[model samples]
Target chain A: MAIIEVNGISKSFGSTQAVRNVSFDVSRGRIFGLLGPNGAGKTTAIRIINHIIIPDSGSVTINGIEAGPLTQRMIGYMPEERGLYKKMKVGEQLIYLARLKGMDYEDAKKATKYWLDRFEAAGWYNKTVGELSKGMSQKVQFIATIAHDPDIYIFDEPFSGLDPINSEMLKEIVLELKDRDKTILFSTHRMEQVEQMCDDICLFNNGRAVLKGDLREIKRSFGKNTINLEFQGNAGFLDELENVRINNRSTNFAEIRVLNGESMQGILKTAMEHTEIYKFERIEPSLTEIFISTVGEDNINPKELG
Target chain B: MNLRQILLVAKREYLTKVRTKAFILATVLIPLGMIAFIGVGVAFAVWESDSEHRIGIVDETGRIFPRLQSVNEQRYVDVSAASPDSLRQMVVGEHIDGYVTLGEKNISSNANPEFVYGGSGGLGLQTSIRSDLREAIREERLQRAGVSEEVKNIYDSQIGLDTRKLTAEGEETEDDTGFLTIIGVVMGVIIFISLFGYGGLLTRSVIEEKTNRIIEVIASSVKPVELLLGKMAGVGALGITQLAIWILAFMGLSAAAAPVAGLLMQDQLADASRLSDQTDEAVSNFDPAVLEIPSIDPLLIVYFVIFFILGYLIYSSLFAAIGAAVDSETDTQQFMAPIMVPIMIAYFIMLRAMESPDGSIAVIGSLIPFFSPIVMITRIAISEVPFWQIGTSLVLMTATFAGTIWLSAKIYSVGILSYGKSAGFRELLKWIRER
Candidate 1:
């Protein structure tokens, strides 16, 4: 059963429609990725799900209940902007936040201690948050968010400020939480991370979801018919072949697009006559290529994509 | 939202503030400095007391010299013998403050003593010397006029008048109590103003936290109202603690300084007593009760505490609301000006009440909740205020406080999370309308 269902959710900031008819669902114990470039309404949708904001013309359900205070208790949200009291001690801050999520003092203390130790940040528990590095503070924030052990977790760019080693550790922790039957929704521009961790992906552009499905299915649907033939000698063999276009030709390789009627055997026989082929294979499209194609390259300005 | 959570937040705030070096210095050093200041003031007063003029006399006429010496040997001046040139040089060097050169003549036409002063003699010293000389000359003239000493004394006696006042309830008290009442009113005003002013500081501190985004994390585990109440309670506790410490320190310093003050006062009283002995007919006759210190009413102190807390809470909630509504401290100045205007007006009204406790302005201002906390205390100090007025003012103030809390809470809930823009009056109106 779907743990969270967002149907036709729409929200606008002033006259600009930030999220228009955005819809998606997360099943129990699965990792859902909301992928988009900057200002793509991913944060807006996440905010609506967290109930920090209300959708203008749609409904959201969590564990069969409509969004409200009780539903809020079941979700752990880490917002894009960092929110932590810089002057407060790390352990005290974490426990206080945990207690806010409905833990008693004793339970909050134990959980805070455990999480701090697990993150190898036990020594920093007594230090003020301002004294810690950005990555260290981020780790403390992560602990505070998850200390309540909510049923669902929403992380907005949780890995943005993390170092490679810490980011890997956080990814492992997120996967472990998913394994424990906790549904998670994470929004990011890192396509490679999504490919590795997300079971289902939703791609958004201009406040609308343009592509979404199982990761494997979406990749499969893009197909694998294009081929690259690297040849030592290929001056003018492409003119003799029927229904084949040499997309590009270099000194030792030619990228060919074969028409539907053209056979692979015919292409191979033609290539054999022309030159000794160093490499010949069909290529699957990368996520970067698929995102660029589906979302359209016009809006995908390189500077804003990151 | 629970009481415990509110207390936890309050405790954190209070502890953080108390542990800071600023709080420690303010709490400890201010009272000590006040004592040192008072000590310096008293020392100056004492030094001024001794430096007043002392006149030396060198009289060739025995009759005039004896009389002049008797008059000059009082508290303000000392009389002794010296030649005219020696006296002049002593006056110039300030060895003698001033001197008199007596002419050799008794009831003669051309024989008046010459007086001289050292440097720029002040008005007080000049006045003293002139009065003494005039009195001596007048007596000599009276003796020459064939009036006997008894008749002269009788003609020169001063008559004293006593006063009594009747209250609205037909009760009579001495008019001297009016001055005592004024002192009491002044004390009450001091307490009332200090509490309200410092309590506003507490509220502003809370608002600073919200504006700085520190309150978001705090409120995540606590309710907004709890946070508000806890801060008020915590800061109130700190204020009370600081006040108690100040009062205790003041009392201790006063007790330690009282002996020296008493010694100086005793010396002044003794000099007055000696002068009174010499001029028994000159001193005015009045009842000792007119000069007695008035006793403090415990009930008045109790009323001060009650009004202080109520007034502080009322103003503080407004301050806190203003703090939350604005995004930054600089934006708060515009709102603060309007809020403080009423408080300033109220304080001045209270001052006016000190002069005329039963004036129309005082009566109306005391009845208004905004000014009642201050003006009522002044009225209670000077004259007997009707119990019903106090009751009515309390009820009105309580109602106003309740209303303020509800309204501020509405603004607080919306404003606490808002950022980026300066929340203007129009936006506030919109927030209220939306709520």
Candidate 2:
């Protein structure tokens, strides 16, 4: 069952149309990614879903109820710009945020304590946010978002400020919530995280959703014409390839997309003449390639469409 | 829309602000600072009044010299016997405070007496000396004109005006109009300061939430109207708490001051008798009622609180809206200028109300919502304000603030989420119009 159904929401600020006919849905017990570049209306769409902004057109329903204060309580949103009261203590700030979401004081405190312990940051409960390191405060902000234990969680650019280890930990927690049958929605430009974690996604380019649906199905529809090549030598012959679009190329690796009527074997032979190939495999296009191709095709048209 | 959400926000705002060291310091220091300021002023007045000046008079007009000596025997010395150089040396050596040399031309139609001093005293000292000389010269001129002692005594008698105020109840009482005017201005000033001081605090808190980026998180959970209302309630309560402390402190100090004021009055009477050389008459004739402290009407305090809340609400909502429109404190100056004008006008009108409580300016000022909180309170303190004016002012203020809050909420809801660009008046208007 779809927990969140955003139907054709449109929003504008003055002459600038921020989101136009953007529509998507997230099913229960799933990780949904809103993949987009910067300034691509992802934040605006998320805000509409959270009921922080009233869309110029369309409606959002959460569990058969229209999005509003009632549905707002069902969601936990961590915005791209994370903030806590700099002078407020970690525990008090979290509890305050939880209480704002309709949690009782005792429950909020208990939840705060549980989350602090879960993050192994119990010692930082009394410390003010200003006194914490960037990574530490980011953890506190994450805790604040989840401490209320809402059924739906939304994170925007959640891993931007986290170190690799912390990012891994955050990913694990997000997946853990998914295992518990909680619906999660997050927006980011990073495709690898989306590819690894998302069961569904809506790719945004210029405030329009160009591609969306089940992540696996979307990837499968892109076909197996793309090849992942790993080699050791001069990769100079990649320049001589025709009818193939080279993407994400490094000194020892390349992802190649063969257009229609292009021979994958001919490209592999040319790569072999220039370097020794250690690995070669036919694969469906990555989210990165799909995003580039989709957005690239979108850029070809006039951008300011009504 | 949610009372619990508003209360939650209010609670956090109240606790966080009250916990800060700045709040504690401001609460305690302001009353202490005022007391210190008043104490210094009283001490200076007492010291200035008690001290007497010694003058060396070189009366080349021999007719006036003896008169000057007879008027105040201890203050004047006949330095006419000394040479000019010796007199200059005496003045330089501090033998005398300075000298007054009167020539024959000085006692004529327009006397230009040369009264030089070593600059040891303030303008008060100079004024006293000049008046004394004028009196002596007048007496000398009168004696020379063959006027009798009885007529001269009649000329010397000073007439005083005894003022009394008729109360609304039709009883005449000791006039305390001047005293009450001071009280009224003080009350107005307190309200003005609280409105500005606490209003700025509300604005700063809004800017903090917006700039620190916590506004989105909070706004998502609660409506912007709830957040603004909550902040105002929390910060307003804090202001009232601080004011309560100050009022209590004022009451305590005044209670302790009764005995101290009595002692000071006694000292003043003693000094007066010594200076006038009429010991029995000065002390016997001194009426304590002349210096009596009038009782304040408790109803005025009730009015004060009503006006204070009304004024605070009106200004704080505007302040909060300004905070939302700007990204930083530095950007607030542009918006602050417009809001500051009415507050300044109200303060100036309060001063005018002190002088003529029933003046047209006072009457109109008290009726306007922006000025009424200050101007009306001042008029109420100084004179009997009619029931209808008070009622009208209260009604207008309450109605005006309701409208202000509604308008502010519209602007606040959109302004909080907008980032990067500084807001202009056009932008603010658009936000207010955004649905």
Candidate 3:
């Protein structure tokens, strides 16, 4: 069953329409990746789901209840521009945030300690956030978001400030939550994390969802025409190839996407004559390719939308 | 809005703010600094006002020397034989406060010869010396003019105005209007300072939350109005706490001040007339209590608190709104100018209120919402205002602030999320008008 149903929700700031007819749902025990390029209304949709900004039309519901203070309490929301009181100690700040979500003081403290320990940040609990390193503070902010143990978690670009190791740790925690049957929604431009972790995905471009489905189903529908090629010689022949869109071209590497009615073997025959073909194979499209193709093909510049 | 959420927000605000170094310093420093200063000042005053000193006379001519030294032997300051150089040495050595030098007699000159002295607070010495010398010269001159002592007394009698004020109840108070103005102005200034001091704190706080993105996170969990009220109440409670500390400190100091005052003034206060510039012989004949500190009504203070809360609510909401509307503290200056005008006008009205507490201008000013917080307090201080007028002022100010809270919250909710560009007046009006 879907825990959150955001139906035909639209939002605008003044005359600028930020989100247009955006609709998506996240089933229970799943991590739904809110995929979008920059300024593509991902944050707006998340905010609407969390009820930070009232939508101009439609509605959002969590477990059949409309979005409001009660629904908000059921969701742990970490904004893109995350913040904590700089002068406040890590433990105190986390507990305060938890208490705001209706946790009792004792439970909040316990949850804060558990999360701090889980993140291996126990020694830094008494230190003020300003005294922490960037990655460490990011950990603290993440801990703050989930410390209350809400029914749903919404993170806007949770991995943006994290280092590779911290990002890996965050991905583990997100997936671990899904294993425990918690619904998770996170918005990001980084596609690799979503590809590894998301059970479902929605791609937003220019304030509208251009593609969305179950992760396996979306990939299955893309067919096997995409090629990841690694060669030992010149990539000059890639420019002359027909019915093939070269996504990236370098002397030793090329990522090629074949248009419909084009055969992969036709490109392999040409690549074989021009360069020593090291590796060429049909594969499913990556979340990155899907994002880029969908977003780029729409001729939608999110910068202009912003 | 849930009361628990509001209280939770308020609690955090109070705890965080009270922990700040600035808040602690301001709360402790202002009152302690004043009390310490006044305490040290009293001790210094006691030392400076110590008893009598002797003066030296340098008479180059032996003839004038005997006559100058011929004055009374017993006086606060007595003349002793010493030259100008010797007197300078004595003054430096603490042997004498100062010395006076008489020039060589002016032959054929009618004006008295110039004499110079180096000392402070020798006015009593100056008066007696001048009178004695002039009397001696006058006896010589009067003998020539055949003028009588009775004629001299007739010309010397100085008459001054004796003023009094009768209140509506036919009770009289000494017309020490200056004291009333001082008390009234002090009360008004205290309120004005706290109103802005704490109000500006709330504004800066809003800007801080917005800039840090803390407001956005919290805004999800609570209404903007609840957040604003929580901040205002929390900060207001802290302000009251600090004020209470000051009041207690002041009262404690006052209790200790009386005995210290007695010990310090032991030599001076015995002669009750020494409190005034009028001679003991002169004022001792009349009532000793010609000047008074003037009493203030206890209820006036209660009115001050009521008006203060109302004024603080209005200004702080504006400050908070400005904080939301702008990006930083630098942007607050232009917005603050409009807020400051009413306060400035109220201050001016306070000045005028002292002069005519019952005048049309003062009456109307006290009735207006903007000026009532400041001017009305002064009006209450200057006279016993009717209960109905105070009630009306209170109701009007309360209603005005209620409306201001609703309006400012609208601007605050919108401004908190906006950045980069500023919200102009048209934008602000739209925020107020927007659903």
- Tens digits of per-residue lDDT for model 3, B192-311: 888789988888888888777777788778878888888888988888878777767766766666666645554454466567666565533543233223455677667777877888
Specify the CAPRI tier of model 1: incorrect
Model 2 misplacement above 4 A: A297-306, B40-60, B64-136, B259-293
Clashing pairs in 2: none
Candidate 3 lDDT, A21-131, residue by residue in tens: 989889988889998778889998998898877888999999999998899889988888878788888998888888888899999999999988888889988999989
- Model 2, span A1-306: residue lDDT tens: 899999999999999889999888899999999987777899999999999999999999999999999999999999988788999999899999999998999999999999899889999989999999988988888887888889999999888878887789889889999999999999998777668899999999888999999989988898897999999999888888888888768999999988876999998888888899999999999887787778774473322211
The full ranking of all candidates by lDDT, starting with the best, is 2, 3, 1
Per-residue error (Å), model 1, residue A85: 3.0
lDDT of 2 by residue, B1-435 (tens): 889999998999999999899999998888788879999999999987777778899988788778888888888999988887888888798898889888877777675687777888778778878888899888877887898999899889999988998877989988888888888999999999988899999999999998789999998899999999999999999998998888887777776677677678779888887788767576777665544456778998898888889999999999999999999999999999998999999999898888999999999999999999999999999899999999999999999999999999998999899876569999988888889
What would the per-residue lDDT of candidate 1 be over residues A147-181, giving only the tens digit for each residue?
98899998887777778877887788889999899
* DockQ score of the complex predicted as candidate 1: 0.19
| DockQ of every candidate | 0.19, 0.82, 0.59
- How do the candidates rank by DockQ, highest first? 2, 3, 1
- For all predicted structures, in order, the TM-scores are 0.68, 0.88, 0.80
Candidate with better DockQ, 2 vs 3:
2
Q: By lDDT, who's the top model here?
A: 2
